[model samples]
Target: MNQPDHEFPDESRTIRPHAGESIEDTRNWPGLALVAVGLVLLALTLTAAGYGFAGWAVIAGALCGVCLLGGIGIVVAEHRRVKAR
Candidate 1:
């Protein structure tokens, strides 16, 4: 009778999580918060700059733009961190 191979692969044994592993470490909460704040500020700035429905739309667009830029900045920073790791 032929016997089957019983050896497990090395990769399978190395998949355990580390004791200090944390989801928070990889998250950029502070950067995201800053982006939110910047968006609010941009909205306020646009509102202060005008009035009426058109003014509100302008303000919202400006705020969205600022938020987009801030998000891009945060994403770039995160990318750098990932590359470093």
Candidate 2:
């Protein structure tokens, strides 16, 4: 069988950077933390609703909103930073 066109080759390759080439930093801890908090709050919200605890669910849902907004804010700030560069 032929491999799909979208598949990358399995051959090993070596990459060499030219002079003055610097590796870029690719860490996004704040956004990752916000996303993780949002996911945990999502689970809490679901569990609370399943247990018929409307109050807990509401609180968790509100926290979920905050986490989501924080994630969005991080993304927007990062985008602006990259655009400015």
Candidate 3:
């Protein structure tokens, strides 16, 4: 008997993980920690302004911006690094 025609090839056979791909998706813990802190700082910034601590609100906002940008930079860098190989 002939085998039945399939709709598509098995996808897993054609796909492979990048060499740099982490099973745990955990690179440096510090980067994840910074992202977490940035989120908290952003929340705190809004709270600080609401509580009338204008100066602290400004400082926290700036720090939050820095952390957000840095985390984004790290992600871009990792993507580039993996794709290059």
CA lDDT scores, all candidates in order: 0.62, 0.71, 0.73
Residue 64 error for model 2, in Å? 0.4
Identify the candidate with maximal TM-score.
3
Report per-prediction Cα RMSD to one decimal. Answer: 9.0, 11.1, 6.4
- Model 2 misses residue 19 by how many Å? 23
lDDT of 2 by residue, 1-85 (tens): 9975552322124243333222132434576678789999999999999999999999999999899889768755765564455
Model 1 residue 77 CA deviation in Å: 1.4
Please list the residue runs of candidate 3 whose C-alpha ends up more than 4 Å from where it truly belongs after superposition: 1-25
TM-score of 3: 0.66
Choose the strongest candidate by lDDT: 3
Clashes by residue pair, model 3: none
- Put down candidate 1 lDDT per residue, 6-81, tens digits, no spaces: 6543334455433433224456665577677777767766676566567666766777777768765875677566
Model 3 agreement with the true structure over 5-59: per-residue lDDT tens digits: 6644333344544554532356534566777789999999999999999999999
Candidate 2 lands at a TM-score of 0.64
Q: Model 2 off-target regions past 4 Å?
A: 1-27
Instruction: Give the candidate order by descending lDDT.
Output: 3, 2, 1
Ranking of all predicted structures according to TM-score, beginning with the best and ending with the worst: 3, 2, 1
Which stretches of model 1 miss by more than 4 angstroms? 1-23, 34-52
